[model samples]
Target: MSVDNSKDLMMIDNGEGDEPLSQRQLNPIFASVLEARLARRQVLKGSMGAAMLGFLGVGLAGCKSDSDSDEPVTDPGTEQPPVEQPPAELLGFKAVSVSSADQIVVPEGYSHAVIIPWGTPISGALPAFSLASTGEDQADQVGNHHDGMHFYPIDGSSTDGLLVLNHEYIEPRFMHLSAAGQSLGSGGVPAFDAQVGRPVDEVLKEINAHGVSIVRIAKAQDGSWEVVQSPFNRRITGLTRMELTGPVRGSDFVKTLYSPQGTATRGTLNNCGSGPTPWGTYMAAEENWAGYFRNGATETNPAPREHARYGVPSANGRYGWELAADGSDRFVRFDASENGASAETDYRNEPNCFGWMVEIDPFDPDSTPKKRTALGRFGHEGVVFAPVTEGQPVVCYSGDDSRFEYIYKFVSAGTYNAATADGSLLDEGTLYVARFNEDGTGTWLPLVYGENGLHEDNGFYSQADVLVNTRTAADFLGATPMDRPEWGAVDPANGDVYFTLTNNSRRTEEQVNAANPRAANLHGHIIRWAEQDANHAATSFEWDIFLKGGDSGESGVATNIGYDPKGDRLDADNVLSSPDGLWIDPDSRVWIQMDSGATDPFGNCAMLVADPNTGTVKRFLVGPISNEITGITMTPDQRTLFINVQHPGSGTSGAEFAAGNYVSRWPDFDDSLPPRSSTVVIWKDDGGVVGS
Candidate 1:
């Protein structure tokens, strides 16, 4: 999700600054490991620490997903990490300079164009984007705040494909023209009493703007992309009906008034990052979904463990959807308090139905998106699948995406076969939480019901219960709490798993550990690991620091060398902060995108490419002011790259926004228009592979 410096925005930022909800202190502190290794040696020698742990963690899954057409794109069964190619052979573009300009910047030889900004019609009535677009219009147009996305080529054609993307959140101040005149509440939302409520239609529009979009895009003869209207274009909004699959299905804990049998729910909220499954399905993660619900449990009837661990509010929800003036079930469901005699008769369990990865077959428009609960419930940033064999248990990884949260690995119970692989393989699996040790090694602890003290005495009655309260179970298992683990990428060239620890301002000096070496972690870092014997399903692995994201001029600064001074890759041109979005191209070039309010040397949030073999980092692209550079993908030929610029004017103060002064009006830089999040298509003037 795109983060901002605003103090009042509760729903945005993917809960990056939410007060650390984890109170259980039994988990091992990562700082202890670093202290043991570094001890009194304060003088950092080289940029890369001398102790360089060998691993090339890719930004994306490091492999190509299947084609959206009938034929498979690439066989995951035959996938193998090719021998590392030389850095000079892949990275051919000159580094772009950082900038504070309210526009995008790329290398001298590259060109870019914007397409499908928020409110651009893709299906149905095809409403043109304007401030007057209605709640119903949003259902047919592109959603606000584009985040994680993937490009599924149509029949192997680079020019035609289904471009599926996730809308992480919305900025109400910009969404509604009425908000410009009204006095605002937190995050510039129109101030209103809870009972009197926000306008039902306004609330409806915000909800309509919060889900996934699948649009058919084709390259025109002029070498530009445009939206193609067809049955393939669909919008799965916050009100779209979906199903709950796996062990958590039909469980009493999730029995809500809407789903009496506990088999389903409505909407996927706060989608952050996304990835393609081995079976060609797209997985949209449910991140920061807890902020959408309010549990008004009193002293007698307390909130459940699932709700409490996730920090469900006792007051108004982030958007106050529950307080819609019409009092419709669609609006009232956001209030998760006990309204009836029992949990089964109320919306108390509606929050439980969320916080899981939603699987969608982009090719099948009629298919209901399934929430794969077997992967466990938490703040899932995204899911990255490891390369699968012809007959092997499929493995994948996900991070909780909150401060001090642990990383997770899910191994499927059934084996994979290219001819028969489907979503069912994800239904029965072992969910493991990571525990990074002091010796630069890590263990994957299974969250099974009977094993590892996950029994009744420990508050886990079954595998469903264990997964429902996954964070608590990891705490009991003594997993290592990381610095807001955001996204994971398995190197397509090497099996090493890479995750971006996107920062933790609360981690004190005393809490510094090996996996998270910095205290007051305002600037984030990336950590990578290779599983035991190069096996994705392996229970043990060796870990190391890939890159530390910060500036020497910033406070709480450590030596820029990261963990290995000898391998210090961070230079004046490549310094970045809060590494939020990550993707590696097929050639093993790691692409890192930023999300914080970094300035000066690191100007705006930018995307940088790194050569894993040589540790050379260079800026690729920088976004406009007050926007997050996220959701990257490329054509099968790897010539055209697509990335999204989200929440472009988010940094403006509430007073400035109320006065109709936006921080940016990007893509459409006119005085009458507000900044709209949009996708950018970039290509080299020479038509060579992007970043080459």
Candidate 2:
């Protein structure tokens, strides 16, 4: 789905005033100029190549002709080391082909089974899911639109684990219940607004569906995974009470009536991408959260500049939830209008409480979730940390997940001590925005108030203000505006960070640069960078385009020098567009998942595996039509893989639903059942390691 551009605002400094720039207007002209300078330097270096060679006492060797003889020349006194072959497991299965089937397609030797689908009951007391299930029932059952997920092994046991999932958003047609007590095709496309105006129960259900779910899943005696009832199984809905931690906890920006001290708040919305901490916790990201709030454009005192920058709308919210206030603070908080004299007396600051990285402890159901604000928030896609080492400060990287947004990193103030490390380690950190130079280098500019014009003179008063308005701070630091950056993964063996810059159609030819070279880039690309001296906490780094997403048949497909498969040719099977989900497995192979739309050249969304060293990408699996392949994880043994198929048959219309002409009926494939998002488990039929 296209992001709401108005919500993804970019305030640019153009010398006259802070002009709002659309994604297309926020070009990489600075990067282009830097690239021109680098090109000139390269020309100068080439001019002195001969002189440098002479100074090094090396002779210039000319190409030998075939007439010089094709005889083998060997040095008699020197011995050559034998070539070592990669393990068979390193080079596993062959790549699959592009598929448009209305089902999950895996490699030839692999088999898949549905582990959990939307509305599956996990709590022991919850009733089994059915068309007649109530809104309260769904609060305890599995949520809709499963996006990012992670598997945490139970006591380090590979056979059992806690599955943590993020339910991004809902399909109203599939979720709203009818007056006749039926759910499927009850209210249609307008159900989202209808639920907010009346039937407040339906709004409650959606609120419950928008957060995170933690359930215990274990391998049965037959080797299939099954949800087991345990105390660990819990649903953290939009109404759940959570504590605010770090810099912005008691700041004025987050002083809502519900949280007068700004120490706590209720719920997390739009949980998109996710990650797991080394200390066994889940980090759920809040993306596209601005649409949930109504900012009241006609209000006497408008929202502050920071609020506008984050795209809190100046009118009714996307779902109009505020209309269902009905004398309760729950629904009323969605309206960010100045209802009282001060911020603490109303819900004006409620929008500020969201758009953060919420840390949840899956092992302890009673533990309250924490919103770690020190990480700096701005539509956080996800946060992936480098491999943790004792005595070294932990470093985590995150993408802003919006058009023309910036990527950020957080280096903890304290050194990691695995025994005592927890979410508290994330509480104190220096947030920095990445500035990618066109000369194949990048810098992490500190967002500290006094360090880089992030002071009152530049409209920032405190660190909390800087952290709350991170996008504005990044703009002041002159960070490179990127394509929609979705997910980031770090190579375990080599400390290289890889990020998926999902398509940016707004970019024009004038915006293309050495890093982002595509104009009107519909097919996105992945970029990887190695920090200075392989140090995760370093401010400087070297980077290059890992691979470009496009059809192999298309001419002039852009690719970096070393990534070209065969003298600038791209392998057909490796062609994929709009890369989104990314994961670096324990074996060090990078698994890339695509989020291609219907208009994309690739037939359906797919998951591909790549040898990071070779840049050889091969398709692994494909989802049903109009579905996004997201939320990937694997067992400790690497024998079982879990993948989420979200919003199968998403564009089904009201007429189509009434006519029983569904686009996709996946997982169950039953004509009587409505399509639902699901998580599928894939493993080799021979019980070997996945991809083997």
Candidate 3:
């Protein structure tokens, strides 16, 4: 797929942390495999058995595909495993070596294929991927910078399913051919020329590129996967109509020129990590969305508390989308200044419409996505729901992906009954922010309107106001300021919750606490907790640092900071830096994806699998350069794994871009094409569970 936004990604990739890959012993299984192949070769060299054995499939393990050339993809031997599943919890594959190459690197015997890249046609008129595609065409094609994906199997068939993913943001220079290497804005964004403004169609096209894509995909008879045309293929973009649900639905905070009643809004911006609901729905988290809106209000006349708390810009917006040459209302909405006769006459309340978890029905193309405000709004990095019980309160957790931000959980007021529960359960819930105590126990500080300082005296008017100012409310309650908390996952076996604190370059030694032990957490860490008595709705819990992500010298906690062991640094087989995307499969293997700007010694961002109990982590895959490895999922049978590679070959210099070159031209190494973000389907040669 054709995608853009190199500069935007370059900005985020400018973090601190680097490391070298450690060496590991090759799997002894290879010796046995070689012997078996040799012994059989003489007996069946000319028989049908030899013809069907496909040497590539049964070849020795631990070899990476040579993606740089036109060589055929290397598959595991032709022998398929039995229908009965093998051991599902073991990390069977050997750790892959560190790589900074501009190609995907999976364990030997595991093959991966790039699927829907940005601009890949799946619905509507099925427009082909091209730099000249119109904004209208983008809405009908795959969006850019794919993130947070999941595959919903059709009738439980692992080979067929709906592949859904979120398109985070875009790079105007790379997205628009007219501005290539020209008119650069902050962080390499496409700037608005005061004399010419921005082309209305270009801005529209970018907006259309930021949202969600649901495409049906199926495995071909030859083992490769392809996009399947289905009625469910759809794109939900920034211009799509979405209803606001929960306490803030009709609240004045979201009132705008387009929706005075405040019951609905246009767009879902900055979608980063997401989760699938127990009821077969999808929830996309809005992260770093504040930069999309601007308020002209000066420092002396600052924007509203909601906007100010979330870092809404006081000047130009991120893309300056509001400066579209035609100055359309949809474009103007990006300007949230209180310039009208009142907020109702302008887009003053527009910023309030974002930063909430949006729920969409992948199977129902016509269903309007719902913004579940009861989950509380902030810089939502992603969401993870606790395993549901027949009649227990629905519980889910989310992290605000900014330095010093807090983690929060929402417990539904109404108990969950799978047969009847829906988004409404999220509409009436008690949202609680976390407070990490040095005593190894954590508290869930409730954000209910009249509780604690969250009342009129503190400027909170109602539940809606509390949620709108969730960060501020959490601050008043002395919630733990984290190291830029990102994605979270809950262990299906134990209900323990794990969160990735992806570094905080600002915290000082004076601010380091037990939960966040490092002052300048250059290489972030993961923290996990088990609810009291193993109850998801428990208000108190025990917590500890799962591990500190760093190179050899910088890895591990050296002091007994509370509950965890005081020592055990990252070894060669499992070195990592800014741990970001996280997921716990059904078998309890902890999957970690990296996202760091300065991933030197460690090469580019990579994926790893870990034993939650032993704190043992091993590299699983390494991605292309200037790319952040995020978003992951697998088929129901766990035979096929899907992960997203975003902003491949990013961080191209203006000069380099002007010269029509990029850091990488991955997925399609053609020199004429820019780097693109796309979904990758990975499978083992023997049809075994991934990671095993």
Candidate 4:
């Protein structure tokens, strides 16, 4: 019934510098659940149900620890050295159980804390935050929504590192004290008339809060992980200046009235899941950006085909950012405007700025991010690259984060040279779309110029046309429709590619297929594809459904995921639901993160670990109420895990909220401190490898 059985940490409240001390033992509630599962195995061992796999193979499931197993917390100062581990070996990683709570929960011997929360000021000069602050105040602080993150260890240091985190989308209610709680922009237009919408200052404020934040993190010798105050910490928001790069550099499509030569843009927005390139660059995907712009009809030669590729409607802007500034024309032009006096000067090129994969070198804080247009984009959620090897094409796979969109891959033109471990060799590449043939096999269809259905008569006039309007180009060649693809992670051991198809509601019951079986699909599944013979540039691959979500018993059979109907591992018994963010640790254990939206009946989202080699799943941690568990990664040493809890208590309003009894008061539940959305690290009490 429960997983964690650890006792609550005894916190010292000395008003300053005091931290919580964990009492090393399982949480009582989780201890009981583990015992029940063990006891059930004993009773059913010889019974009719025992005839199943666990009863016939290896041995029956049983509990390993008892009352005598209660271990004492050891001081980290005198702890022995951590043994080095191979990438395929788990070392001492153990799947400890954790107690379930409406708020954040972790396993025994592990501790968590909120490191940085929404609206937390990064700049020392910015004023401290108050939840009651107006939209103006939110501008100077950390953005409201937090998503994908990466932890890079400081060179030659064991306890210090850098954190690059995405702020994702903004929450208007929490950011601005608005009455209806929605952002009040007049749809991407300039607010020349104060009566039009939210002030331009407000629009710019939100834009400035929607990108990435970098901070220094440290794990003290005592085993406590905290944010280190330093000048390296900075925020890159929607208003931040950025430069463009790649084959399409200086292209006409990228040209804007603001930058006629197409060299730069404002910022990255709607960022979703991400990956790290072989050369240590962070690749953050911008998902669902089509909703942010408004289209004005004043342009002369609008490209309808190009506009449809990005889902830009020929009407007013969606988010209304134009009314805030005079050149507000820049905000709503993604609408495929061609009403310009001449073809050379038309605004149809506006939509080209977005949908490209952006590569940010986190190490070089001052470097301009490169929008790798060579890797065609369509609501990108992630860019997972195959491991680099000498003379092998550097390949990266990505999922288009929209219902019925297609998955894509980019194969480098030059072979990956381990000699140059730097990323320069990745500049040129060939992009391909996927086609899942009937009979279970699939092929990577090339979207190259002059390829089948890519000619001028097919709507794509040239190679630039195919790259700029990627979606229509894919549609022209008939790429298979996938169920709302999200994040992707590659298994280090087997090299299997796992992607999350975060439920799509548009499919009707009759449309249900083996890959996407459910109509409403409240519970999503993890799809793993193994490229043909480890060739990242291969043209074909085989796939299988690794796991699907549903309650056990007769209900889960519909998912056909090899679920044990009468076992304790049933979906109802286990809390792992709606897999979203994903990562594969050194040992190949798939770490799953969830983004439980409105349709998710589960209280809050959580994280779990699954041994892909064995299909054994275990819940790891629970997020704060109303929060999404996202951005998971393990330190190179595998001694620590970093995860983000975003938008906790999101639905609370002025009328129903309270200071002490709010929807969630995580990390400081007793009203001792104000709570904020944050990233946390969970490690064992003995300073052992995390998850061991």
Tell me the TM-score of each prediction against the true structure.
0.89, 0.88, 0.86, 0.78
Ranking by TM-score: 1, 2, 3, 4
Per-residue C-alpha lDDT of model 4 across residues 290-404, encoded as one tens digit per residue: 5566454334633244444455544544445655544465454444456565434655666567776777877676777777788885678878888878778889889887666
Better of 3 and 4 by TM-score: 3
lDDT, candidate 2, 218-325, per-residue tens: 999998999998999999888999999999999888998998899999999888899999898999999878778877755455566556766777767655667763
How accurate locally, in lDDT, is each candidate? 0.81, 0.76, 0.79, 0.62
Per-residue lDDT for 1-692 in model 1, tens only?
Answer: 01111222122122432422322343546545452123112211222223322332331112122336533367788877696653364678888888889999999899999998999998888988888888999999999999999999999989999999999988888888787766453245676666687888889899999999999999999999999988989999899999999999998878888889999899998998998999889999998888788989777766776876677878888878888998999989999998999777889889899899999989999999999999999999998999899899999999988888889999999999999999999999899999987666679999999997888776678888888888878978989989988888887887768888889887778778888888888779888877866678989876666777877443221221223333344666788889989888888788989988646667889998877765677889999988999999999999999999998978877677767777788979998888899999999999889987
The CA lDDT at 285 in model 1 is 94
Which prediction has the highest TM-score against the true structure? 1
Local accuracy of candidate 3 as per-residue lDDT tens digits, 585-660: 9887889999874367889889998866444578999998788899999999999999999887666667777777
Score residue 236 of candidate 2 by CA lDDT. Answer: 88
TM-score: which is higher, 1 or 4?
1
The TM-score that candidate 2 achieves is 0.88
Model 2, stretches more than 4 Å misplaced?
Answer: 1-28, 31-89, 179-196, 553-561, 564-568
lDDT score, residue 341, model 3? 89
Off by over 4 Å in 4: 1-102, 124-127, 131-141, 177-196, 297-303, 313-318, 325-348, 421-423, 553-569, 572-575, 598-601, 653-662, 665-675
In angstroms, the error of model 4 at 413 is: 0.5
